[model samples]
Target: MSARRPIPGLGAAPSTDLPVLLPFDRGKGRTPDIYLATRWLASLPPWTPLLILAVMLAWPLVAHAQGRYAYSDAFDALFRWMPFLVFEGFFFNILISFLAMAIGTVAGAALGLAQISLNPMLRRAAWFITQLFRNSPWLVLLFIVLLAFPFEIVIGGVIIPIPDWMKAVFGLSLPIMANISEVVRGAVQSVPTAQWEASESLAFTRRQTMWQIILPQCFKRMIPPWMNWYAILTMATPLCSLLGVEELITLSRQAMEGEDNHPELLVPFFGFALVIFFMYCYPIARATIWLERKYSVKL
Candidate 1:
């Protein structure tokens, strides 16, 4: 213990007599630390977020089921009406999505082609229309169509009533149409100039060239984005519930309210609705990815 520890350019070595403590271990019957658990979770794969969300959602549901709300009569009622709900709202969602896709594709393709028309007037007109719809908020467009369109058409004393749900379909289709138009325009432009020259060399007129040569090639490019748009459109169809369309969410609400309007039933009813939407949308998303990979042009 004498004062003889001074060194010229080196520090004193750490004392070997002191005990060293390793990082905290969750063994020896000790409780696990929250920080370590969180760190481990954070180190998981990218898909863990979705898995965590599923777990978070399911945990409460499991707890509620095992706890005071164990009877789950609301779920029984929901199950009882499952077929009806599926046939009504779920069916309508699919129907509305397809209808919008069909109309939007046709109208959007027309607008896209027109945007690149030889005539300046047609090009300007198409641009104006596309910009109008594309810039407008979807909900605003839906309301406009819902309110502006006549409830019924009177022609020669024959009345043809337009259902509110049909109006919703029209509203949803507007945005889809504008988007698909852009997809068409971009896909068409993505084609190589050499293809255009080859078509011209084959005596193909501009219209003939677009339809016969360029468009066929554009289809491959268009499909992946089209499926993507379809998925989006399907998700957006829930907005129709606001318009009294009795779509999935609307019907779910009705079911929940009809079951004595119990607070305990809220999670289960909505969870079922979430499952329904997930089942429908998940496949489209997977298919979109697959198609994009499959149909992607080599060029």
Candidate 2:
């Protein structure tokens, strides 16, 4: 009250008052204020779809069993075959999809890095290869490989036809490689040019800077969309059935075609697909969460 506040630099931290302050910001974000109505709802996952599924399931009330198969009966049919559907149809496709995805990832990384190389001729060649594969329908690509590409491998003197399994691998890998190449190229390019310059100025070669400084950062940013694309490719693997690959959809169709099997195996088959994808993909999803947190990407 008597104008006795002349002491300086004692209230806030010293660095905040200093002109050349620490560059890092380690301060915690302010806690968000919660409103009464919305506080309890903030923690839920997106629930609209589940609510709709509940409504549909409730539509098949068994209180009015009309001596006929109700909607509940259909659900029951699905319930009976869930285990077999998961084992035969879901597991096989998931395995094949994982392998093909691994192949695509390796190919895409090489293709993308090649596209970004300083060598003009190498970039052009890589570009052409990627374009050719990307433009081709996966089914047609598989057919060409399966029907025309000589499946024979020449080892020493004897010629052995390439295993049909390898053929499917080749077919599945090509188009996925093309798509992944584009994704990788885009992700790599998305890094700011200044970052590259900063890295290079620090004495790193282009490859070293890209790998050691850039790629890890870019991929951390790219995971969500990248994972979404990978998920799509995983869904597409069943297309291998067209090429006679013994993957999930192929097995599911076979099971459905079995004697004494209800046609509704298709439903459980689809469910199995969903379950497998969700189960195995939780890691990627958690990875995505960690990436978003680590990189501070926008929600």
Which of the numbered candidates is closest to the native, going by highest lDDT?
1
What are the candidates' C-alpha RMSDs? 13.4, 11.3
lDDT of 2 by residue, 1-299 (tens): 66675444674344334477455654565433212112222223444345545554554453343544444555665556556767766676667667777887799779978998899999999999999998898888878888867769788999987866567767778877887788788788988899999988889998789888888877766665456445556656777788777766666666556523544344444555555655555455455444545665443
Per-candidate TM vs. native?
0.77, 0.64
| Span of ten consecutive residues with least summed lDDT in model 2 | 33-42
**Which candidate tops TM-score?**
1
| CA shift of 9, model 1, Å | 33
Sum up the clashes in candidate 1.
Answer: 0
lDDT of 1 by residue, 84-134 (tens): 789987998899889988888899999999988989999999989998997
Q: Which regions of candidate 1 deviate over 4 angstroms? A: 1-71, 297-299
Residue pairs in collision within model 1: none
